[model samples]
Target: MSLGFAYAAGFVLATSTGMLTLLGSGEFPPWLWLALFAPSATAVMRARNRQAPGWLGTLIGGGALIYGTLVVQSQGASGVLIGSTSGLLGIFIARLVTRTTLKHDLQALMLSLLIVIAGAGMNSGVSYGISFVAYAVSVVWALVTRQLVEGAEREASLPFGATLEVTLARRDIVTPVFFAASAMVSLVVLLSTSFLFVLFPRVGLGSFKMAQNSGLPDSVSLRGSPMAGGSGAVVARVKGVSGTQIDRGLYLRAATYDRMTRDAFVRDSELVGLQRSEWARLAHHEDARQYDVFLQPVTDGHLLVLG
Candidate 1:
């Protein structure tokens, strides 16, 4: 029963990681949710009557990995997308290994670690931090339970096959004291890690920094300015406006589309390979005023700047 709990916790963590990755992507497709949930649901249903079929699980997992790879290839492999794909693959492998092996408690936990790593990679919001804490607590419970179960099996002096049938008394391991101790340990570890993270020095990457950018769409709408008078409704609210008494046209360039087709403006892919020095030269200004711009979420993931 403890082993079963551990497996269930691991599966839940993996699912949560996948969900967080999808949420971080800022665009969720219906099929992505289906792909995430279908295999786990099927595995649960199969576990009720008999052992999960290893071959079937492997097939499902392999299909998901392939599909995730295709998505990364087509979508330009952002950190969140990479993490999402890794979580999916981890889920598949966890399911396959758990169904195939009798001594799979440790294996499932290890596979769940992959999901945790993926979650770390994809995290951007406060919710992911909460999920991280939950995952950590679950892991502590799983590990403690697994240790108790293994100790009990070792003490019984039974054959390996007979040990599988050995049952542990709830009072022996699942007592209130045990839970409190585990929770305390988990909390201490969490606090220590957070403290260390806070103390770590942060460094910034300058113009040559490499980061993934979302692929550009063919056409973009050059809408009217947000500050225009007689607009229908306010699309965004700007704060911290002070000492601005100039009545002039303000243009914020989000992206440059150099290739125009019959119906849409496409990005010139060649421009991306330009050297840092070339870009610096092109962007040089004799008297450029620098100010921070805080933009709310938009459909496309492009940086908007005013020159």
Candidate 2:
């Protein structure tokens, strides 16, 4: 159950962040970095000599640095720069705090700041701006609740379930507190997951929608005549035409669109009913063209054209 819970938590965290990125955030999607959790599982081993690999920590630190640099460069100097810089600096400060005399007291504060600020910086956007903070809080709350559960379990295991009589140390109390706190964290995760899913757009998987450009007014197809002194890509050539026969605007269809929505043009279904005869007539006309047609490699699906 513990392993299942951990894996589910990790997956949920990753998947939620990934969805948010698609919704137009600049943050490094958590789903892409969930592999970072592998090192965390080392705590479960519990063997006397078992320890997390130093390389794991180094990799995370290095990865964060590289990620910060990329975010700074891609977003321009002032876009996400302040947030990214703050996050990286926070991580450094957290590491220093962990190494000092006030380490125990400052650990949670540093860790919380590192996750909340860094995560927010990594994936900034209007809709998902607070996601990182929620995620950080959830994690901390879960840890606290888990600790509380462990202490409660230990006390309950005593003879006659003597937890009622047992006095808990501050450390012991903390674990149960964490366990209860996990309930609230779970709720937050559930809410965040729903928020992302409901708002994230569902775009066609293969088609890319280029941003609008008003400047490029003229367009030409591959079947259009070659430019002066330029060898154009041959999509088709007319044959069996007499010397005087001239071609006008020849129609070429590269893809078909059938379904139209308020915002999208979707692939038309080939399902036949009353439309069979109408479609057949069009197909017959297309087949009669004496054009030696060439087609570029395309998605492996049936292509249809309508005049």
lDDT, candidate 2, at 281: 31
Error of 1 at 70 (Å): 1.6
| Poorest stretch of ten by lDDT in candidate 2 | 96-105
Q: Write the per-residue lDDT of candidate 1 for residues 1-307, one digit (tens) a residue.
A: 3444443544555444535543454344545555455436544753564565666666667676766676677777463466355546546454643453325645655655665565555566776777667667667776776676676667567565335334443334365676678778889998887666656524222222356343466565533234423655433343433224111223344554444555766665332231233223223334654544455424233334443
- In candidate 2, what are the lDDT values of residues 123-217, reduced to their tens digit? 55665545654454445554453454455557678886646224322344434454456656767776777566646534221122255342333
For each candidate, what TM-score against the reference?
0.52, 0.31
Structure candidate 2, residue pairs in collision: 27-122, 27-123, 144-178, 145-178, 145-179, 146-178, 146-179, 147-175, 148-175, 148-176
Backbone clash total, candidate 1: 0
For model 1, the stretches where C-alpha displacement exceeds 4 angstroms are 1-28, 34-49, 77-80, 83-103, 156-166, 203-307
